[model samples]
Target: MTYSASMAVQRLFPTDEGHDLLDLTREVVAKELRPKVDAAEAAAALGEEFPTDIFRILGRAGLLSLPHPEEFGGGGQPYEVYLQVVEEIASAWMSVAVGVSVHSLTAFPVTTFGSPAQREALLPGMLSGHQLGAYGLSEPLAGSDVAAMTTRATRDGAGDDGAGDDGATDDPAYRIRGRKAWISHAGHADYYTTFARTSDARGRGISCFIVPGDAPGLSFGAPEKKMGLHCDTVREVIYEDVPVDAARRIGDEGQGMPIALAALDAGRLGIAAAATGLAQSALDVAVAYAKEREQFGRAIASNQGLAFLIADLEAAVLGARAAYLFAARLKDAGRPYGKEAAVAKLLATDAAMRVTTDAIQVLGGAGYTQDFPVERYFREAKVTQIFEGTNQIQRLVISRHALG
Candidate 1:
């Protein structure tokens, strides 16, 4: 019924600041996010209501910008510490955790690749949580093939079209026309960091733009009925002659692929941490159930079969945590972490898929229903492997890195 990672997980973070931040994170997740999860998820599954209120609570708490600079209203923490916060929150509620991670990913382009003027003008509100962002990269045909995207951003004459300054700018603009599928915060975010083709070259033609939610011709499809993470809504972001100011562009033309891959290198680690937390939560529920549930005059956990399974699940959770933590440390230390990020995502998400399913086995028939949260965890675990680049794509990244 409750969620907590092992206390020993703190040993991974040696600094006092890490401990304090994670302590605050645990308190927030337990007090605010966990209690409302079931009902919120149920409601979201039936309608288009994403948890804007809970999201604002996190933003106000400064959890929304953990890895960004303090100058831009971020927490200014290292990814190593930020990711643990993600894991902790995820143990309580995967949807909120995913939402936080996606929001962070949405900010990456502007913060990391944007021009100085763009950062000064936009990053403050974005980092401060006055605005929420959705990353628009994956299209219906381009989920993993970044080169296959069809979204295009063409230079516009001027802002006379009047989208209310059009992402709050007066610079030359671009008319973006394309649909991004499987966007995490579609219909609910304040801005969209859109990627579109500016040339015909597969790898060199793509460009990134910060498209406002109110930009003309920007529309969202109805929410998709996904099998898990119900409260983290996903929908299509359609841009039809949507005018985005040139000032809102993140970087030079034809730089989107590299920028996107760079962001994914970090985002994958966030997802890896989240998947570990989900597995950890499922493990906790299974352990508690096994310890208390009686079976033929003995607790189910007393049986070697169930106990070893639980033990293995625990090991998998620990391994997953270690994998993501390793990648996060690499990122925090300012080392090249792309390959390690892929490895961590591959290990953690696959481990989550296995661990949550095994947790259900420990619960037997009781695990199949909504009475326990493990079923939800099981469903949630599945998508982690599919998104942030599929586990298949992670393998490709890893293999290429290793061979090179």
Candidate 2:
């Protein structure tokens, strides 16, 4: 079953424009993404290959900037609407959907915490759909414990004229020196939203900076060999004495922890939505195969035992979708949704893992082969429980909120 047929899942939009945007997204998925995803993913798994053209196509279609403010080249769509678009994309291509989520996370600091001047100068390009971004928060030693990060950004000498190596003038620059690990689009992004320590105040010492991709001393390591979502391109981003103008900093010094946490809340929702889509696709394939595959001169779907399993998969996919949509609605209404986001991420990703695994079982011997997509879906679903904070971290967030 192709993604287009999987659109049988009913959806509700807050506005006519939202409905149209989804229609556009599905059309693009059918025409552009689904056609190329298998070939592209296979090529990427063998060597270095990033879907630069596909991103450009999405950018030009205005899909990349849907959640940002309209005043600065964004579509100004609500979180609920933007997330559905992400889910639709994920149904067709999981790697591209994850890329969209990571790109949105990279812009979260500037959109949510940047000063007026920063927004005016940077947002147009960032949200213009012409640029891609990477989030630089995790490090080799500090994946979950963000405060343990050793990346340092020191203020330049007082006597020096605040001039960048590129001859751009911005007073009071800072030199960043560190490495970020497990970064998506590490070598291909137009800019990196990076966090580094500036003081000795533990969590209060860090700050955020937007470093241009062309910045001197910014380099990337070879991509990590991963089990799935190979086209997403995970890598290490090395910042060796990279200079950034203070003007590029999103929030004030000592505010990075809050900024990063807030961004994760939103990022978690993205992951949840994507996971739901993936599960839906898996369920769709399983159902289609069950109806066609035969046993004892009858379709296997006629067997009550197999049919019950299909029903459970359907229930899990719908439950996951409801979980994320509820969280998205909370975020759209300007309410505190951190705990809900964590819950959604935990539920949806766990559902994805279960649904995809069952989908493979539904196909039996055929599923274990590359001839069917369930094997690939199983591989992709495993990582959803790991990234955007592990399901373990989600439980911690939910417990803290409940206790408080």
Q: List residue ranges in candidate 2 displaced over 4 A.
A: 1-5, 158-172
Question: Over all chains combined, what TM-score does candidate 1 have?
Answer: 0.95
- Show the lowest summed lDDT stretch of 10 residues, model 1: 159-168
Task: List the global CA lDDT of all models.
Answer: 0.86, 0.90
Model 2 per-residue lDDT at 153: 91
Q: What is the C-alpha lDDT profile of model 1 across 1-404, one tens digit per residue?
A: 44354443644564778788887887787789888988888887787778898888888888999899888788888888899899888888899899899999999998899766677778898988667889999999988988999999888776433222324546547889989999998988999989999999767899988888888899999899988888888999999999877777777788888999999998999999999888888888888899889989999999998899988888898888888888888888889999989999999999999988998888899999889988999999999999999999999999998999
**Candidate 2 structure quality by residue, lDDT tens digits, 1-404:** 43343588798999999999998999899999998999999999999899999999999999998999999999999999999999999988999999999999999998999876677788889988889999999999998888999999998755233222222454437889989999999999999999999898967999988999999989999999999999999999998899888777778788999999999999999999999889989998999999988989999999999999999989988888899999999999999999999999999999999999999999999999999888998999999999989999999999999999
Best by TM-score: 2
In model 2, the clashing pairs are none
Which portions of model 1 show Cα errors greater than 4 Å? Answer: 1-8, 158-172
What are the models' TM-scores? Answer: 0.95, 0.97
